[model samples]
Target: MKTAYQQFISREAKLADLPALVALEQACFNSDRLSKRSFKNWLQSTQRIFMVLEQGAEIVGYGLVIMRKGTRLARLYSLAISPTMRGLGLGKQLLIELEKQSVAVGKLFLRLEVEKTNQRAIGLYESMGYKVFGDYKNYYENNNDALRMQKAIRHYSNFSRLPTYPWYQQSTDFTCGPAALMMAMNSIAPKVTMDQKTELDLWREATTIFMMAGHGGCHPLGLALAAEKRGFSAKVFINQALPLFTAGVRSEHKKQTLELVEAQFAAQALQKNIQIETAEFELSVLQNALENGGRVVSLISTYRMDGYKVPHWVTITAMDQDCLYFHDPSVPDGHVMGFDCQHIPLAKEDFIKLSSYGKNKLRTALVLYPNFLNTSLD
Candidate 1:
């Protein structure tokens, strides 16, 4: 699609236009500029939406948005306007054009980051309905921070009908389970505190004592017990009754200790009225629970999201016809901050591949309900 303002028009960029695009990007930013090879790569990539604005056949502004492999969200990687083209509304026009391009490819949200000192750019984004969700310190080449921002590109979204999910970042690497649990609980009940004190407290409550290395991770039953103790209704789902993640530890004594801990967590869950289901979890069961006003904390393999080949925990808030949106407590690698972790819009097809972890493909999750039934998130 081409949008024109008299002689100023926007259209897709071609490979031959690489030099002009690179020149404009260099002229716009003093640091954190994209390499010429990067521009060429993006230009040739099928996942990239590259658009250039032209004034009387001269390239004046450009924007690039990239669609991820398995998700329904797009990232506005970069945008630039010629030095003389400032204040002509070219930036806004280019941004709008790029948003349309992203939506055309079935993306639900358009996310990006901008230098914090560039208030004009941030103002332009905010004025256009973008909201700042998180930030990254010392993100730019010159040590300037970047404010993470995004806008729901779709005019018709079903997210409003779902519960309001809060996002939290895990202070330490191993506390993802506790962090995800906190977000899920707070989403249903606002009284749930998310400070580091609560995070560490829950970790202390649920750790399995020995994992693949170092301190053990939180077991599914352990997480459920912690949630139930906090006055929320919880149901644990797992395929096998055998203790989960024993393969993570090689020591026979450590494995036995983990099994005993899991058994204790199981007994406590039963004593406290937390239900445990040992059947294989169908995706529809998880969706149905959410439809009936339940929050979920699930174990996922990070390989799909970042190739980490490790087990991680995340909270599931809601789902729409096209995508599954959740709050991940840990920020993914290769990112400046946890911006992309908040309300992440991943496709359902890919989520199935992500929700299971390790060999034997263990599937486990905890579905939770707030203390007071019918809690109004509105």
Candidate 2:
């Protein structure tokens, strides 16, 4: 019979079955093996249910559950399988059966305890929609902590009705990561209107200093510092990936670049009594920073080859309810550009799609200061 069929039985154990159950329990548990007398008590108790699996009339596995009435909760007491039968999907099947029984008994939730070191068991529970609700420190004989996990059976319709933003816009293939778009929207816009002569002077000065620095594409950091030196709080926003890749290649090269820029601005700000913030992020990073009250400058690139080209930088000047206003460096006349922020709400699905385009090629950065007016350091 063992070779031909397998049987699973959920029934009360008889007095004669104690010796076999005790042997199985000893084989299953290492430190906390159950005694024959304890097995008998559990089997005879009306509040508990003992389930056994048999292959050809030989017991192979067992599980115990403590069913409590009025509270509508079921606690899994123990589950064990023979060493040879491990990873046969039997454990998951037993858990499913127990859940069905609990639901049939009108239980509203199911709970279990697993050791912290037991990653396999923890993963199984988590996959079954069980979430950690509490912990029992040093609960096991080995002093290992136990994680208490629970799964609710009730369906709450109200939870699913909460407001949600759409993932993408249909009219334009131009999409932004939800987090990146949010950061751009949340960032305070640049101020301090410059006359054409002042702007041109600042621009020429920045271009000269940046070109002499031999920093390749990192000229923006120098430009930002030059702007701050002249009594204006300067923010430089660039694509996030450029710095990340640079940092990865040189190991602190990107950090060193920002640190130099910040140090230069800090010295000038101190003399002029101003404050500044310098930061970086990829699309995802920007969203997180924005949600945390960080201000940003946005560098909007020119669309190229079905995507945005690099080297284009912009300073966001102001944000209305849904549109972001910015000064475009690529426009040749330094005109302030306006874009709809609502169309850029960063959603995960949309990010997954857009990020898939260049494989995280888009990047942005931010630099902020308390005051935009002070003195010209450039």
Candidate 3:
């Protein structure tokens, strides 16, 4: 069966192929070349995919992709083709196979850097649907600039193209409402500074002064007033006419105090032209607000996050067919990663269940509008 025809194959790099890999690296680029030691180490990393393309037992092309820990992103670290194999369409095969491997490993996006002067490589990447996101100055060993590019690996046609929302962690345990509000505001306008001082100021303006624990949580009306005072428009949605956060307070005096505070907030909202709807809006209505470029601050119980079952605040960032993505302001203990707090996804049914709190199932939401518009839900 032996003939003059040759066959090509693609497989993972092996440690024994170090010599050929180093030789290829040396022959490919004059600068920013991966060292022999780098190739050896990368070939052994469980977090990286180092692949080789072989033609008739000869390694003619290779590529490397690195998977970041605790993220849905993969990076194309390096790719090369033998000078003799150039223009043979083998490099495209290597890249496509690498992308397949990355998607197999649960990566949602792939990112890479190409030298600014490498027009051929840039054209290849762009042809493959990669987009240039940004650039770095003097990024290479030879002082050449690099163009940063990224591609969404998944078929996410139904995924919402969300606005850029800044994330903020609450400095205190009771400031989740303020932190969540700050994120929503900055999503509407980026000039709002994201700092601890601003977070505490928002908390001071919105706190209800009574809770089950040390500090009080922010009332929906107070939060709406806080947004209004800061040059933004908002609409408050309350599920019940009862005063919020009053069920947990054991004393009658504290209940009266929360009522008084709620009244003051309502008065201020009316004076400032903020809309307060004393009824729960449907999930579809919330979707309309976000689709119109509005941001929302929602109250949820932490029973699903931790076992505590305490009230918490999270900002609804984006949504798709199967999941709702939000930013939880409470970066709880043992879950310190920013990944744990930013754009956390939950099933739509589970999120709906998490949106209510307390024995009476108190539900509240604040929808923030970027400007004066038809915010009325028709």
Candidate 4:
């Protein structure tokens, strides 16, 4: 009997291989095997990483990685090895490749949920640097609990020796934008006060027409205006030319209203001498700005951290060559999604990927420079 394929090759999974994938899933998983339709859907999605380990004509193992559009996390959805090939190192090899693919797609961290009783699998994951963050009761269809594990794949050499900043939880779900803006403003200008009243007031001033499901999120221009109105000099950097939050609003009437509000904010920004640049800001530019007593409020997606299809704001406080430190506004009691939602350190590359919103990865930032009107990070 052929224990494993003599030759090993790894490549992306295609639709044609769906049958084999489904078969392998059935063979490996006693429960929770992905259906053929689900395999087909994942095979065609560019946002996910699906790969199969092949031994000439036979598929021996597979790995699946799912990347959230706006967050710094890449989840290892599944990993499997053939029963006949258990002794081989194919599982480890597949895991290493999955991590590589995850980082290449700009993910800073890797996470997975494993059955609590799967000792061998748990040992493998722990050996590969994953630490158990939490657990869920009755997570599996068979009523087995699952352990949540996470590992930071990227290692940065430089470190920023900066003071710890205050953490603020959003009073309401929709106030992440204002809460983050408040954190950034308070970081740069410590004398500025913040409260729930001010948070809602700022939300009223900076909000667009609609959010993922609520009233609206704060626009970059609107956020800049809000900061400027609070006596902080603000500069806006946006990657997309269109008005922000258009992707979240489906109704044409809402879109038009958002456009009008955006236009109004633009005019006000122009009158106030606030700068708006329609280009991606470089990491060096952000570093320079931070060095010059500037704080950055970035629009990010809550999918990775909160598992919600919504945009969020975060205050980028300090950075060095290796890591970018930020005061995250939406801190959950536990890991609601796959991430820690408080003040956190993210790898630079991952931060770049998470700083934008939507599929196009529209990068936007409100850079508030204190006591430096002439400073420019071009």
Candidate 3 worst ten-residue window by lDDT: 332-341
Candidate 2 lDDT over residue span 1-378, tens digit each: 111123554443456777778888888778656777778888787665567676666677777776542234467777877777778766776677777767776554566788899898888889888877566688788888988776764432111111112111111111121122222322333233333444444344333122112333324444455445434354544443222223222335545655454456445545644333333334544444334444444433344212444333333333322222233322221111111121222123322233321234544445554343433322
Task: Report how far off residue 250 is in candidate 4 (Å).
Answer: 2.0
Kindly give the stretch of ten consecutive residues in candidate 4 with the minimal lDDT sum. Answer: 334-343
lDDT of 1 by residue, 1-378 (tens): 678877898889999889898888888888888889988988898878999999886899999987654467788888899989799888998888888878888888899999998999999999999887677899888998998887889876655333446889999989999999999988777888999999999999999887787777898888888887788888989987777888768889988898899889888887887889998888888889998988888888988656677888999878877678888887554422466666778767778888878887888999998767534432
The runs of at least 3 residues in candidate 1 whose Cα sits more than 4 Å from the true structure, single-residue gaps closed, are 1-59, 66-70, 86-108, 113-163, 334-336, 372-378
Tens-digit lDDT track of model 3 for 279-351: 7667777777888888889999877555676888889998777557788787565313343456665556667
Colliding pairs, model 4: none
Error of 3 at 97 (Å): 18
Best by TM-score: 1
TM-score of 4: 0.57
State the C-alpha lDDT per candidate.
0.83, 0.48, 0.79, 0.77
Q: What lDDT score goes with residue 93 in model 3?
A: 75
RMSD of each: 5.3, 22.7, 8.0, 9.0
Q: What lDDT, from 0 to 1, does candidate 2 have?
A: 0.48
Of 1 and 3, the candidate ahead on TM-score is 1
**Model 4, stretches more than 4 Å misplaced?**
1-156, 333-340, 372-378
TM-score of each: 0.75, 0.39, 0.60, 0.57
Residue lDDT tens for model 4, 127-240: 898878567798889999999787777765334234546556678878888998888877766666678988999999988867656777788888898888777788888887
Sorting all predicted structures by lDDT, with the top scorer first, yields 1, 3, 4, 2
**Candidate 2: where is the Cα deviation over 4 Å?**
1-14, 154-378
